[model samples]
Target: MQQGSQKIYFFLAMTAVLWGGNPVAVKGMLGEMSPTMIVLLRFLGISMILLFFMFYKYGKAALPPRKHVPTLILMGFTGVGLNNGLQFTGLQYSSAVNCSLVAALSPAVTAVLAVVFLHEKLKLRQWLGILISFLGVIYLIAHGSLEVIKNLSFNRGDILFLASQISWAIYSVLGRGVMEDLSPMATTAWAGVAGTFFMVIAVLYQGTGVTFQLSNFAWLSMAYMIIGSGILAFNWWNEGVSSVGPNRTAIFSNVIPVAGMILSVAFLQEHIGWREIVGGLWIITGVYLATRRSSMEPQTT
Candidate 1:
């Protein structure tokens, strides 16, 4: 493999680690911070971090082009705003296990959405990979109990997590266009600034007070969400979509559930059944099939 390809895969894998831990962090913040506050603070903190770096590098041109301003704002709304908002809120009602399990849908969701909106095509293997991965998610979450999946007692939180995945899928597809000129960090920075603007407005409108007396763990959790997941993972994801295309890059998202499940088992003491092992294999196989070097070339516009 070429050096560039290695870097791209590395970024995607690290992004998975960050993204996977996001729900566990959110699970920690459930009682300490309101969902809106978490979203507001996360974006605000990341935007500030990104701005400092951009200003040092480009000075006044840290501001994006005027024509790109609106698109950036919309991207922020969907990507950071709606996506994080739904996720944090949903995490309040759902277990971290459920949230991560549901997030496993993101890759397939992104692929289908890309085909519909971005006019991207998938090789047959990639499509099959997506299907198999989805089935794995079902089996793992349902613990191999088909009746549970058949009856599918999805609560508000599960539905919201699904929405969050859709929001992110749209964000991922939209990112390909935006990255035409901007680097991954630059793109995440500007959209984050735009997204933070709207989040602040909503926070104020809702009269949510910022609580300062958080424990050390809560602070650390928020920091992870801001720096690790919000900033780094996003930049990595943008790079993946830009260089490898969404379908191949999104396959890495399968790692999120696996990571979240492990962490949840350790930290949250969530129980796991035999189905996790079986379902996880299906997901791994699907990712391997979907991301084979021969077919994983970047799609053209």
Candidate 2:
């Protein structure tokens, strides 16, 4: 590979690795901070930085047109607001390993959503992929037990994670329309601001405003969330996309759950067993099958 290509790959790989650590970092913070507080503060900082970048890029155009305001707010609410809220709260009850493994199903979920909302038809391969991915999530939630399904018993954390993914999928679908009017970074910045508004209400309602007395570890985790996962990872992923195209950049995302599981086990002392291994593999394989562009599809240079 050319040196330039190699560098893009490195950044893409690092983006996945940093994203993999996101759940672990959030899980770590649960001990010292409330979920609402964490989401609020983390996104607030990220939003500010993104806003600065957007302004730099678009100047006065950074402010989205008035007609797009509601859509952006909805995107923020679903994508950032509800997504992170459910995720962090779920993490309070779920293992970071489980969170990461389940999260690997996002591409599949987004594909299914596209079928529903975008009127897109799926190929037989994509259908099979979606089915397999669904089964994988069911297996994880059931803890590899048919008896749990028979008894209607499921992990609440897993269910919330699933809900959170759906919320994020909605955001992604909604974003397709918004991106026609605004750049991705601008959409993210404005939506992040709107999401921060929602989180403020959430924090107020939860009555868990920041204590400003966080432990050293909590502060470190906060910095990682805002800077490492939020800003740096995002910028790197965008760089990969701009350099190598989204398909090539997307391939790097397959590394995220693997990294997350390993980091969870290594850092959080989380245990993983046959279920996580098997289910995670199923999710990754299914996502690849569902989202990969076929040879017949038009290719972007």
Candidate 3:
């Protein structure tokens, strides 16, 4: 690979690594903070810094046109607001391992959504990949037990994580439309502003009193989310999308579940068994097959 391509790959891999720890970090902070509060604070901090950077780089151009504002807001609502809100809340009822396992389905969901909304063509291999991934999700959700499925005993957090993944897929599709008229930085920064706005509303409507009596570890986790995953990962992911398109960038997410499981086990002392291993392998394999470009397909980068 060329030097420039190497740098993009490095950043993309690091972004995946950062996001791999995301669920574990959120799990750590849940004891000290409500999910909504954590979402509010994280995006609030990220928005401020990113918006300032956008303004610094582009001046008034950082802000989208008035007509484009609504799309950006919607993007924020789905991607940042609903995505993190649901995921963090779900983490309360689910293990970080489960959270990462569900999240591994993101690219598959995005691919299917692209077919419906963007009118993109799906190859036979991609369709098979999606099916295999869906099966993996079912296996994980059912805990590899027929009784869990028959009795309808499902982990609430996993269900919520699935919802969050759908929300993020919608956000990814919607962002393509907005990016036609704006730079990725502008889209990401303004989306952060809009997401932060929606999160503030969610916090107020939930009517829970915010508390700051958090331990040092909670503070550290919050900082990591705000800076590492929120800002850096988001930016780097967008940069990768801009550089090599979403398909290539998304394949990097295959690293997340692996990293998440390890971190969850190491830091949170969570257990992972055959179910997570098998399901996660299926998911990672499916995502790879679904997103990888064929030799006959034209390359953009």
Candidate 4:
């Protein structure tokens, strides 16, 4: 039990580190790659790596069942293509700290979706948790002042980030049952293939010309987002979820913002003011209280 607990911590910590650095890396790439192209390249890279591993382990590249194929295609678009495209778009408008911290509201968003769509019941404490989490989000969105939100004086990047969260929530709700039918690796691979179509559309729509002379540093950042966050962090998160439980494992997601906060400041030189500190605290605490009761729920997001 102790060993498993330690492993969960390790896996979750690794998840925090990689995911933490993900936005910082993406923000750095904004100037080098167009948003859709970044999404396209990420899907392509992850698809290849996952397919290779799947074949090596199982000696066959198993595909999603026919019944699940259509749904998986949708997941691929929403989860990777759209999610990443908006993420990069929002990064163009917002600070890395704001983006990462706003994403921390995902579990809270998932809880609400559960209550509404899944028709799940919650205790009084859970409702309170939801309220508190939203309050934190509101505060963060308002940037420590209710006046800004009231006057609609928010950054375009922050709004895009919130939209990205919705995209992620949709993916979470839909990706749940798909994971039941396919291995995590297979599901991700198929989705990446599906997302490639959208990436092509984005490129053609934007009339992006091929730029092959990207600096080595830009390529390195893209590779980290592809390999580090997409592959390693994903598997580590799944390992943690399997060893502990989704509810317990989900707590580590809070660490992602903390790590992001540090790296954003250290590397990106983004400022972390009062709103982020206070808002992040409430969001993290609310998630803990809301999900304190464990179930066999899959942490899809």
Candidate 5:
């Protein structure tokens, strides 16, 4: 039990690191690739890697049951297709800081969705935490200036990112059954493969030119997203969920924006204002409050 707990912590930490680095990696890829093209390549890389693992592990049984095909497709669409599509599209127009800050609200959104859709009950403290977290996000969006709202011009990208967050929350809520039934590796791999197919179609429709200039930073970025965030992060997160259970596992997601903020400052040399720091703290604290458990339910067999 002690060893398992340690492993879960390691997996969660690794997952946070990879996820935190994702915005920076995506930013690096943006110069040479369009958002649609980048997302397509990301899923392609994920699918290839996952498929190899599936074949090596379960061989033929790794292929999902025919009855599960629809569920897998839905998972792909919600988790990978729409979630990533909106995120990348948003990143094009918004600063990485904004994107990360918005994404930090995922726990709150997930909690609410779980209550509404999954029939889960939230304690009063959890509801307060969600409210506080949302307010922090709002402050971050406004950049300490309520006046900005008067002059606010909506960036298409920001709207897309918001949509992406909602998409991810829905995916997390709806995936409970699938997660209970399937191994994390199996679930992610199948969904990744299905998402790749959809991404290819989207890429073709967008008609964005794909390039492979090794000298460009875009290639490095693409590699990072594919190997680090796409494959390793998902695998680690799934392992963490398997070990710790999803509710507890989900708390680690709160660290992502913090990591993103630090990376943006260190690597991207982006400016961080006082409001951002304060707002980020509020969001993180709120998420912690929201995700804390009064008791653990028995693990599924």
Candidate 6:
């Protein structure tokens, strides 16, 4: 690979790794904070961090123009506002493993949206891969309990998690146009600010109060989410999408569930059933097949 390609891959991998551990971090914060509080503080922290970068690098140009404000707010609502709100709320009911498995479907959804909205065509292998990955998601959700379909209690959290995934998919598809004219840092900063404002409103509506804990784990997790996943991962992901295109870059999201599951098992001592193993393998295989390039030649729009 060329140096630029290698750097893109490295950044993409870093983004996945940071995002992969997010479930565990969020899980840790659950005991210390309310879901809305977590979401609110997360964006608040990220917004501050990004603002510093904006001021340092671009000075006043970091503030988006009036014409772009509406688009940025929309991006904020879908990507940060709804996505984080739903995911964190879902985490309250579902296991981290469940949330991670469901989130693994993001790439497939993005691919479909790419085809529908962006008019991108996928190879046959890509379609097959998406199908396989989707099946894995279903398997994980059902836990191989086909006989108890109707008896299965649907958790509100699970539905919210699914909504979060869809919100993110829409954000990814729609943000493509906005990204054409904006720097990733500017986009992320502005969106985070908008999301933070919305989250504050939601928190106030819910009558949530902020409470701070000096516990090492909670502090560390919050710091990681703010710096690692919030800033670094988001920027790197936007950069990867810009460099390689979303269809290719979206595949890296497949790594998130795998990493989340592994961490959950190792650190949390969570049990990994046969269904989870099989489903995870299928998801990984599908992502690989979908992302693999057929020829060395780079695709051009």
lDDT of 5 by residue, 1-301 (tens): 9997987787798889788888888876677677777777888887888889888987897787777778888878878889988898777787777778778888888899998988988889899889988888777777777776567854567667678888888877767777667777777778877887888788889886666664557777878888888788887887776677776787788889888988888888888899889888888888888887766545532
Give the candidate number with the greatest lDDT.
Answer: 3
The Cα RMSD of model 6 versus the native structure comes to: 2.5
Considering TM-score, which of the candidate structures 3 and 5 is the better prediction for this target? Answer: 3
Per-residue error for 4 in candidate 4, Å, reads 4.0
lDDT of 6 by residue, 1-301 (tens): 4899889988898888888889888888888887778878888888888889788987887777888788788888888889989998898887777788788777777788899988999989989998998777666666767753566755667668778988998887877777678777777778888888888888899997777755899889889999898888988888787787766786687778878888787766778889878978887777777766766647642
Query: How high is the CA lDDT of each candidate model?
Result: 0.80, 0.88, 0.89, 0.82, 0.80, 0.81
lDDT of 2 by residue, 1-301 (tens): 5999999899889989998999999998898888889999999999999998878877897899898899999998998999999988999888999888888888889888998999988899988988888899999989999999999889889998999999999998998898888877788888999999999998888888568888888899989999999989988887787788877777777899999999999999999999999998888888888878877886553
Displacement of residue 105 (Cα, Å) in model 1 is 2.4
Best-to-worst order by lDDT is: 3, 2, 4, 6, 1, 5
All candidates in order of TM-score, best leading? 2, 3, 4, 5, 6, 1
* Displacement of the residue 66 alpha carbon in candidate 6, Å: 2.5
Q: Using Cα atoms with residue i matched to residue i, what is each candidate's TM-score against the true structure?
A: 0.83, 0.96, 0.96, 0.93, 0.91, 0.89
Query: Mind giving the per-residue lDDT tens digits that candidate 1 earns over 156-271?
Result: 67678779888988887887787777777888888888889889888999899978899999999989988898778877887787787766785687688778888888888877
Candidate 3 error regions (>4 Å): none
lDDT of 4 by residue, 46-111 (tens): 888888878788764375679998888888778877778887899998888888888887877777
Candidate 2 error regions (>4 Å) = none
Give every collision pair in model 1.
none
Model 6: clashing residue pairs? none
- TM-score: model 2 vs. ground truth: 0.96
